[model samples]
Structure formats: structure tokens, C-alpha cells
Target: MNAVTRLLRDLVAIPSVNPRLLGPDVETPAEEPVAEYLSVLAKKHGLDVSRQAVLPGRRNLLVRLKPSGKVKKRILLAPHMDVVPADDSQFKPSISNGRLYGRGACDTKGCIAAYFHALCQIAKYKQRLQHTEIIFLGLIDEEHLQSGSRAYARNGPKADLAIVGEPTRLQIITAHKGDFWWQLKVVGKAAHGATPHLGKSAVHQMARTVEILLTEYNDSLKEKQHPLLGSPTINIGVIQGGTQPNIVPDTCSIDIDRRTLPGETENTVRKEILDVLKPHGLKPDFLDLRGVPCDALETNPALPLVQRFMKVARRRRTLGADFFTDASPLASAGIPAILYGPGDIAQAHTSEEWIDLTQLEQATEVVKRFLQEVES
Candidate 1:
């Protein structure tokens, strides 16, 4: 097997699932194993490896390939180590029909493996490195709020480019969407269900609010379309209200997920929703997301490095996806970041998530070529 494939298999063997954040007991967040494992690999490959404890017991690993005492460009290679929870039956990695089936196979383990393979290939020619420095950062908590990326970006070494690993089928992604989460609460007086006229129903009020917000959301989609990223979207992912079916409930709540574009802000989006509900006498609280928001990533397509990479791929057309990634945090820090890697995003977070072996190999080759071009 190729180095990338072998690395992917190794990554799959390690189950680094994110702990439940809202369980009965506070699940201690931990991701040390993955960090330690990556560190070991980096050391074996003769690269300087380091770890940062971004959270208690959770660490981010950084591996660097310094230039051969020259002034080459710098590139940041980043992949999230923590994977979302996997079903009990899907904990182990299995290969079938040239596809690797596992929890993080499509979401990011594939990218991790591909990146390592690329790095391994580059190591063979370390003496030829011109003026480039490649830094590989394996982060934590991307499945939740992107804590690792935020922390790393806050105190990270400056780099010219950041290639965030995701399941992009090896496409160079310059744009995607951002995320905004809000929890809304509606209050009303409770009364018996039979006393229909005697009580105010919070559920009924929330229904009106939801209706108006959906209308506004749909209207905004028609306003303008981003050249790469099409449009912003809104999804009411959760709704809860009432106790007994007959009682006029006094409280109702909804969790909204708003997908934004490059120029959109949380305040502006929240204001649009609030405006829709204000006139209806439906007041609700907007909650802040506990983690980092995945902002849209837009890199200069005309950059020398980007253009060179594209030439290596020999592809004229690129795509923009709707998924959010760690690229946002890195981009916000003034790093030209892009989302690129192997596997289909459609399979991510699915019960039967898998990554094509061919895609993984292709991605590894792409990473190696891009690094060599910039490094040399």
C-alpha cells in the first residue's frame, strides 16, 4: 500500500471520538492519543514535532519541515483530529471494495492520512527544499465549535497559506459558508387546554415567529448570489414546547442554524430574524454559539502559489461547497486558506461513511506536488 493509504489505516485504528458535551455528567474532553500518535509519526519522519494543550487533556500537534536555510514561501497544513461520535457498530475501520469505512474516513481522517503521505514524500527530498516551510497542524474539536483551530490561530506562527483538510474530493475550495446558531425562547401564560380563551399559548406565538423568519430567509436567498458560494441558508434544526397536550404551555424554544456568506455577520443575521419577530410581539433570546463559527473562506485565485498548484492539478474548474470547516479561523487570522482534500463530503457524518481509496491516493499526489512546487 502507498504511504497515504497506510497512514489512513493507522488513523482509522485510533478512535478519537469527541465526548458528549451535554450528557448527565460532564464528559471530560480528551484527545491526547491522536496528538501523541501524530507526534510520533512526525518524529519518525525526522520533522520537528510539538504539542499544545488547547484544552484540558486535549492537545494540538504541530509538525514542521523547515527550509534548507533559504527564503522559500510558507504553507500551513491543518487537519482536525477529533471526529464526531460514531455508532457503536461503526467504531472499527473496515475496507471493502477499495473504500475505507469508518467514522472519520470521509470527514477528515482521509485528509490527515493524505497530508502525512504528502509530507513523507517531501521528506525524501528535504535537501532540495528552496525557501518554503511546511507546517502540519492537527487540531481538535472541529466537530463541535472548532476550539483547536481558534486556539491555534490565536497564538499561531504566521504563515502565508493554510490548506485546511476536509472531504473536498481533491478540489481546491476557495469559498464555503459560515454558521450562526441561536436558541430562541418564547414566554406565555399557561392555562388549562379546555379554557381556550383564558391562556396565552407560547407555542402558538412561536409558530408565528417561525413562519415569518422562514419567509424572510427565503426572500434573502433571491437577493444576490456569490460567484463561488451561491447563497446563505437557514435551518430550524430543533424545536421544543409544552408539557401536556391539553395544557396551554408557557414556554417554547427553537434552535436556529444560519449559514452565512463571506460578508455576513452574526449581528446582521440575528437582527434580520429579530426584525421579523418584533412586530409580531414575539420576543426571543438569541444565544451565542459555544464554539468558533466557520466563516466563509475566500483566497485569492490569482496568488502565485494558488495558480501554481492549480497548474499542477491541470484543472480549470473548481467548486464551492456548503459545508463549514476550520479554514474560517485560519483565514480570519489573515492567512490565505483553502479547503482541499480527498473523499466525498456527502458521506461525512453518515452511518456508513467511507472514502474511496483512489481519491485518497489522488489527494496525496496533489498535496505532494503542491508542496514540492512551493517548496522548491
Candidate 2:
């Protein structure tokens, strides 16, 4: 097996499941194990390694490859360390049909292995990078609140460019949709079940509200389109109402997942929804479910470095993603960030998550070539 593949297997073996996805009584390992392993590996290679404290027990690991001369530009290669919770057996990586199977095999551990392997290869060759400095950043909590990336953006040095890793099938993604979550609650008076007219039904009102939003409101969003990201989208992911079949439901609530495009804000989205329900006299209370804002990413494809990287990857056109990533947070902090990596996003977080070995090797070579050429 190639060095990068071996590294991916090692990373997958270590349980780095995010704590937020676990039950209160469940005892599972977090990102610390992966961070420590990366730290040790970086040190062994004679690289400058450091850790930034994110949460109490978790940290973001950074390994640096400084230039031979004065540094004029900084390039960040970042991949998240945390993974969604999975069965214990999924942590044990397996190989089948030229693919590696395990949790986080495609979601991001593959990117980590590819990027770090490229950095190590460059270091081993003693490439004379006179004006460019490369950093490999292993971020934590990307699957949850994205606190690690947010903290780094607030305190970390601003780089000229950041390549945030995700499974994009090696496509150079310059734009992606953002994620916003909120709950809409409708209240009514409760009374005897037999006398239905005596009590107002919150569930009945909420049903009408959901219908309009899904039909009329969703259709309206199609008009507000972005060239690269297409258009904003919405989904009623969850709903809760009533206690028993006979009892009148006093309160009904629904959790909404709004995929916002560039230039869309929380205020505007809320206002639009309210406007739709206003004519019908449906004034449901809105509750913000997401504590932090996850804005959309739209990196300028015209940037010289981005253009060069695209050329290195042999891509003639830019692409966009519907899912959100850590790139948006870093970009919001004034860094130009884009997503690029091996594997397909379809395989991420699946029961049989796996990445093609061929794509893994190709991604490693592409990153290495980009680093080698960026020195000029």
C-alpha cells in the first residue's frame, strides 16, 4: 500500500467521533486521539507542530513547512478531524474492490492523509520554497457547531489562501450553499377531544402553514437564483405536536433547514417566511435553532492563485457544492477559501463509507504538484 493510504487507515482506526452526536451516558473517544497522532507524526518528520486549544479536551493541530527564504505568501491546507458517530466496527478500516471502507474515509480523513502526505513529500525532497509557506491544519468540531474553525478564524493568522478539505471528487469548488436552522411554533387553546369545536387546533393551523411554505414559498425561492449555487432551498426536517390522538394539540412546532445562498441573511429569510404566512393570519413564533451563522462560500475564481491551482488540477471549469463546509467561516474571516479533495460526498457518513484508492493517490499527486509549482 502507498504511504497516503496507510496514513488514512491509521487515521480511521483512531476514534475521533464528535462528542455532540453522542448520548449523555455514552462514552466515546473524541478528536484528541487523532490530534495526538498527527502531532507525533509531524514531529517525527522534523516539522514545526503546534496545537490551538479549542474546547477543554479538544485542540486543532497545525504543522508548518516554512519557506527556505523570506515568507511572502501563506497557503493553508485544512481538513476537519471530527467524524459523525458510527458503529464500533466501522472504525476498523477494511479494503474491498480497490476501495478503503471505514468511518470518515471519504468525509475528510482521506483529505487529511492526502494533504499531509503531500506536505511531507515536499519536505523530504527539500524543495526550495523561497516565498511560500504551507500549513496543514487539522480542525475539530466541523460536524457540530464548527467552534474549532470559528476559534481559529478569530485568533489564527490570516492566510492568503486556504484549501478547506471535503469530499468533492477532486473538483475545485469555488462556491457552496450555507446552512440555517430555526423552529416555528404555533400555539392554541386545549379542550376536550370529543368537542373539537371547543378547542382550537394548533396542529391544524401548522399543517396549512407548512403546505404554503412548501409550495408557494419554495417556488418563490426559485426566482432568487445564484449563477453558481443555483438557488436557495428549504426543507421541513422535523415536526412535533400533540400528546395523544384524542387530546387537542395546544402547541405545534417544526424545525426548518434553510439552505441560504450568497447575500441571504437570517433576517431576510425570516421576513420572507413571515410575509408568506401574513395573509393567512398565521403568525407562528420563530425560534433560532442554530447558535452560529453558517454563511455561504463564494471565493473569487479570478484570483491568480486560485486560477493557478485550478490549472494544476487540470480543471477547465469551476464547480459548486450544495453542502456547507469550514471554508465559509474562514472566508468570512477575510481569507480566500475553496474546497478540493478526493472521494465522493455520497459516501460520507454512510454505514459503509469508503473511498476509491485511485482517487486517493491522484489527490496526493495533485496537491504535491500544486505545492511544487506555487513556490514560484
Candidate 3:
């Protein structure tokens, strides 16, 4: 097996599932093993590596390559290391029909392996005056609130250009949707179900509220459209109320997922939702919002580096991605970033996640070629 294939197999064998997505007791040394493995390889190749403590135990691994001459261009390569929880049996790697299958096979161990392979080659044997300094970061907590990226952006070194790895099938993605999470709780009086008129029903109130949001709010969102990303979306993901059927529900709660466009902010979108609900006299009682919102990505496609990378990859068409990635935090920090990597986004997080070998090879070549063209 080649280097990329071998690296991906090893990555799949290690379980680095995100702890935030599972029960409290269910925790693995998320990304520690992967970072160690990469560190060993970096040392073996005579490259410098550093680790930053992101959470208590979780860490972000970084590799910086200094230019032979004065640095003229700065580039960042960031790929997340966490994956959603999966069965232990799914961690076993399998190859069938040129596709490697396992947990995180597509949702980014493939990209991580590919990036490592290309970086190793670039570090040891690039035969030209290097005017570019490249920094590769393997981040933590991308499957949840993207705390890793946020932390890195706040404290890490800045770059002129960055590529946040994702399963984009080697496409150059310049724009994508953002994510906003809100937890809403409604309170009412409780009494006997038989004589429901004695007490107000929180379940009833929630039903009416959800109905209006589904019809009116969803319809109104269509008018606010983006050329490549299309329209923002709302998903009422979770709803819970009442303990028993005999008693009227005293409280009802729901978790709202709002997919924002490039132009929207947390405050502006929340205000719009409030405007819709104000007429109905329904306001949030205990709404818990995410501390940081993942803003939509919209890097100027006209950037010279972007245009040059596209030419190097021989890709003429640029499109928007539907999924949020680490690019959000990096972009929000003023780094001109885009998402690009192997494997289809559809295969990510699936039960039988896999990546085609051909695509992996192509993606590795693309990374190498793009790095080689970083001239002063």
C-alpha cells in the first residue's frame, strides 16, 4: 500500500470519537493517539511539531515549516481530528473495490492522512527557493460547537491563506452555511387532564408555536436567498414536555437549529425570530444560546491565491458547501480560507463511511501541487 492508504488505515484503527456527542462517562483520549502518531512521524522526518492544550485533555497538533529564504507567503492547513461516536467494531478498517471503510473514513481521517502525507513530502524534498511558510493544524471538537477552531483563532498565529480540510470531493468551496443553536422552554399551569380547562396546557401552546414557525417562518426565510448557498433554514430538532398523560403539561422545551447565510449574525437572526413571535405574545423563557456562532463562509473568489490554487488543481467551477466546518472560525478571524479535500460529503458520518483510493491519490497530488506553486 502507498503512504496515503497506509496512513488512512492507521487513522481509522484509532478511536478518537468526540466526547461531547456521547454520554458523560463515555470518553476516549480524543485525538491524543492521532497527535502522537503524527508527532512521531514528524520527528522521524526531522520536522518540528508542537501541541496546544485545547480542553483539559484534548489537544491541537501543529507543524510549522520554515522557508529556506525569507518568508513571503504564509499558508495554513487545518483539519479536524474528532469524529462522532460509533461502535468499536466500526473502527476496523476494510478495503473493498478501491474504497477504504471505517469510522471517520470520509468525515476526515482521509483528509488528515492525505495532508500528513503531502506535508511530509514537502518538508523533506522540495527543490526550489521556498518563499512560503506553511503551518498544519489538527484541531479538536469540530463535530460539536467548534471550540477548537475558536480557541486557535484567538491565540494561534495568523495566516494570509488557509485550507480547512473536509469531504468536498476535491472541490474548491468558497462559501457555505452557518449554524445557530437555541434551546427554548415554555411554562404553563398544570392540572388534571380530564378537566383540562382548569389549567393552561404548555403542550398546546408549543403546538401552536411550532405550527406558525413551520409555515410562516419557513416561508419568509425563502425570500432571503444567497446566490451559491441558497436560503437559510430552520429545524426544530428536539421537543419534550410532560412526564405523564394523566396530568396537563406544565413545561415544554425545544431545541432550535437555524442555518444562517453569509450576511446574518446571531443578534440579527434572533431579532427576526423574536419579531415573528412577538405578535403571538410568545417569548422565550429559558433560551440557552451557543456562546459562539459558526458564521457562514464567503471568501472572495477573486483572491489571487484562490485563483492560482484552482488553476493548479485544474478545477474551473467553484461552488458552496452545505455543511459547516472549521473554516468558519478561521474565516471569521480574517484568514482567507476555503474547504477542499478528498471523499464525498455524503459519505461522512455514515454507518459504512469510506473513501475511494483514486480520489485520495488525486487529493494528495492536488495538495502537493498547490504547495509547490506558493511563490513570492
TM-score of each: 0.91, 0.95, 0.94
Rank the candidate models, highest TM-score first.
Answer: 2, 3, 1
TM-score-best of 1 and 2: 2
Tens-place lDDT per residue, model 2, 5-52, is: 999999999989998888666565588899889888887777899889
Q: What's model 2's overall lDDT?
A: 0.92
TM-score of 3: 0.94
- Model 3: weakest 10-residue lDDT segment is 123-132
In model 1, the runs with Cα more than 4 Å from the true position are 21-30, 70-72, 87-91, 191-199, 244-247, 289-291
Q: After superposition, how far is residue 213 of candidate 1 from its true place, in Å?
A: 1.5
Report the lDDT tens digits of candidate 1 across residue range 1-376. Answer: 6667777877877878876443446564446777778788788879889877777778788898888777557888898888877776665788889998988897898988888778967886664466788889898888877888888889988788888999988888888888888888889999999996899999998898888778865686658588888888778889999999899999999898888888888777778777767777877887775545666777778877777777776667666878888888888988888888889999998899999999998888888888877744
The ten-residue window of minimal lDDT in model 2 covers 20-29
Candidate 2: residue 274 lDDT (0-100): 97
Superposing all C-alpha atoms, what RMSD in Å does each candidate have to the true structure? 2.5, 1.6, 1.9
lDDT of 1 at 73: 72
Off by over 4 Å in 2: 194-198, 244-247
Model 1 residue 59 lDDT? 79
Candidate that beats the other on TM-score, 1 or 3, i.e. the better one: 3
Give the best candidate by lDDT. 2
